[model samples]
Target chain A: MTVLGWTRHRTNLPSGVRSLHCGDWTILVSDDPSIQTARHRLAAQVSCFDAGLDFLPTAPAQNIAIYDATSFTRTTDLDALWRKLSDRGQFSVAVRMAADQEHRTQDGRSWLKTRQAQRQRQRHCGTMLADIVAHLKLPTTQPRHTENSASCDVLVQRDDTNRVHNAMQHLARLMQGPPDMRLCVTGLWPPFGFVDLTSKTEAAE
Target chain B: MSLALEMATPQDAIRSSDTALVDVVDGLLRHGVVIRGELWLTVADVDLVFLGLDLLLASPDKMRPEGITR
Candidate 1:
């Protein structure tokens, strides 16, 4: 069966949706063969149900826990974004970027191979990600789909359903990336980076 | 900060890099769900099909190069 998401409690679901009884969590499943259809269904349901908040959309491999969102009284954009997010049900945002790949240290600089440079850049990207995540004070997970430094996915979350644009703005301002790096703020995403999906079944296996 | 960053919907952010709409595909691929099946896709009137494709539909982080861990 194709799994949609896992929730702690069961709720009113539209027709064609079914559930799989798993430990403390309710695993939502469906017969829909279309993966795209499953995605749209999941995205639409996230805002409606608490269980839909954490799932996969190029989610990180690890299960990161979701955190309580802090009350925010920011500017007009954030306020508006929150309202829009509330209406649209956008819950998460991803910041993808390319890191600078250079080893300036004397010994490190000596080994300026292609792979070494790439590794250095990846390290820099990881460091930058940690710093940003720390400053935002939000839960985040590195997406497994991240192909390279150019497409690293850092899922940021907050207490409000998806009222994390201000954090995004702050993140954007703090990001002094290259001109070619384009920052796209996408939403209503599960902090798939934020919740541990490991259930008793996995442990039993 | 007075910097007006554009807001976009997920649909607009799908393929293009510079459009402002809300992007909601947090992870467009299914995480940890590998569909071992065939694929039929069309791009610009071109129909493409693949057999025996083990679809590890998730983040590229899953497709990390050998010896590299994120």
Candidate 2:
């Protein structure tokens, strides 16, 4: 199963380096003179095919992007740290994964009402759903199908709920949610977690 | 596209808020699906660093925001 994942670059990676899939997950490896040395360890006794980082999709629909801020020694306060990042034009990293999927629907109601309104408010949602269905209908479509030499699967992430009972509420929404024309959330998964900013080094090659 | 994506990008109105990043990462860990890979690293440092400490950063509050050079 092909999995999509991502991570943020905490420091300036060496020039010409990208990312790599260490195992089922993606990781960053150096592209220095001993490239093969790094490869030897990562590829050791592995049966899976390694999809180099250059091909990773930065787009949310295509990949699971991650944003980490725990390495900063500048501040211990989460709020202050976030503010510092924001002041310096780096705040976007935090929202990189869910930003595109979140919707703002105008309704005289609470969060639930706003979320419910998204289905009716956006014209493209239907179109997108149709496109997904069309993609799935392809005779070659399979959970592990590789199209254009790239793995394909139903990409889903959370942007619907953020309250105390987010899980239950989301599960409820999933149970009674509107019928999606073509997308399927369940199938083979690659876990997408191994992908980190370091993989970018592999892409540079 | 994932909704957390837009929230993570900085252009969103909520980007500047203190909890926006927290909320986005939280949403990702709780709802985001890593189609493949054994372990997904969501922390910025671990993703960039060649280490296996992502689990430690799962608690968003514990992660410190490192500055970007460019």
Candidate 3:
């Protein structure tokens, strides 16, 4: 059996889901090898978030993810926060992940020129990353990044949704990243970075 | 004696109002965790190949946007 992820209960199981009981959670598993089944479970996991149920997903990380109700913070407040700010009650604004990466052209006139252009775009993406870190007040060293590509997943504080969207979108366009990189302002998701895995570690001990 | 991959990036018109479409793609595809490690490929319950792999799941449109990159 291959493990997919952990959930607080056996509430929302997709096809082939095998629930393994844990001290405070259930491990969702599959009969297929981890590779084949993880993808199927991921698609199911994306669509659903219940107020009463909490889930921990996988990175081929397996179902043994040690989870307890206390280790994770609920962003259900995020939806309420977004609703108060914007009337978009169905959706929320705590987009946990923001990605910006170098842009490239499919075909170009010259290799030298394309390489130069690619590097320029990368610098812009790097700058955009720096801007995001500052905007969110995310604590990190090397406040500026000049890498060829960058991406991050972080918890957003409850600020105005439209403000962050507009600010990011504006700066992204000004930075002139690849179309998608310029355009990618993702939506609210489970707080992957914020959760603690002490339960998993304790289980191992 | 050469191979090439060419993909047209989507310049589709997306209003600021419909960030939902873009958001859905980002959350479902980009946000999904990737599996990276060594593996054994087997057939008929016998291991046939060794694989060192990093795997990500996404639709063609999302993965091929512009071109492939890490």
**Most TM-score-accurate candidate:** 1
Q: Tens digits of per-residue lDDT for model 1 on A1-205?
A: 3344444446675455665554444555556555334334444344333433333221222211211011111111223333322222333333344443443445422433433445444545445555555675643544332323322234443355344666767766767654534345555444443333333333467
Task: Summarize candidate 2's per-residue lDDT along A103-141 as a digit string, tens digits.
Answer: 454533333343334424333333333343343332212
lDDT tens string, model 1, B1-70? 2223344544444444542221234344334444444344547854443233555654454454221122
Which 10-residue span in candidate 2 chain A carries the lowest summed lDDT? A89-98
Segments of candidate 1 deviating more than 4 angstroms: A8-11, A19-27, A33-117, A142-163, A199-205, B1-70
lDDT of each: 0.41, 0.26, 0.40
Instruction: Identify the superior model by TM-score, candidate 1 or candidate 2.
Output: 1
Q: lDDT at A78 for candidate 1? A: 26
DockQ of 1: 0.09
What's the TM-score of chain B for every model shown? 0.27, 0.21, 0.26
DockQ for the candidates, in order:
0.09, 0.02, 0.03
TM-score of each: 0.46, 0.20, 0.41
Highest lDDT against the true fold, candidate:
1
What's the true lDDT of residue B46 in model 1?
Answer: 49
